[model samples]
Target: MAYSERLAERIRKALTHLPIKEKKMFGSLAFMVNGKMCLTAGPERMMCRIDPDLHEREVKRHGCNTVIMGGREYKGYIHIQEENLKSEKDFDHWVRLALEFNEKLTSS
Candidate 1:
């Protein structure tokens, strides 16, 4: 599935004045900071990177889940369903988390 251009625009707007690079990954458009992935807007969901310790708390919310693939889980990386990001406030929740975690997430 192709990433959502509209969602990308919203992310750009939300993160204005910051150095954000867009890249292709996981069949979506990922926004990166300092060479580390911060957020991804896919066709069906937004992949958000945050503090691993907060994963359990976040996944309890509606439309949120751990990042699981091939039976492996990537802590702190979550899939937030599209329905949860319909509002600007909802989107900001993730934007803020991504920004905070970007500082802690090591760049590769």
Candidate 2:
């Protein structure tokens, strides 16, 4: 599968109250809120577009990694392994963080 349907379902449930739009991008299923990128579910993993200020601290978390493309690190973006999302708390953390950042973007 290009992306994790299971993970996508989980994300869908989490954001059920919000108006979310899904699209296939970067070989993943991207969740967009307020017309901005929020999260993406890929093969056995997910990516979050969070606040750049939290990048350093968040990358230190278990199974969390800064997103890198072509050897360049993308701050405020991270890939989270599915293993770390086994618990609802962990999963909610990422979803909340991504939404918070997305909200900030829309507000500004």
**Candidate 1: tens digits of C-alpha lDDT, residues 37-56:** 89888887888999999999
Span of ten consecutive residues with least summed lDDT in model 2: 1-10
RMSD values, in order shown: 2.0, 0.9
Candidate 2 lDDT over 12-83, as tens digits, reads 999899999999987899999999989999999999999999999999999999999999999999999999
Residue pairs in collision within model 1: none
Model 2: per-residue Cα lDDT at residue 23: 96
TM-scores for all predictions? 0.91, 0.96
lDDT for each of the candidates?
0.87, 0.94
Clashing pairs for predicted structure model 2, backbone only: none
> For model 1, how big is the CA root-mean-square deviation?
2.0
| Candidate 2 TM-score, true structure as reference | 0.96
Off by over 4 Å in 1: 106-108
What are the runs in model 2 whose C-alpha is more than 4 Å off? none
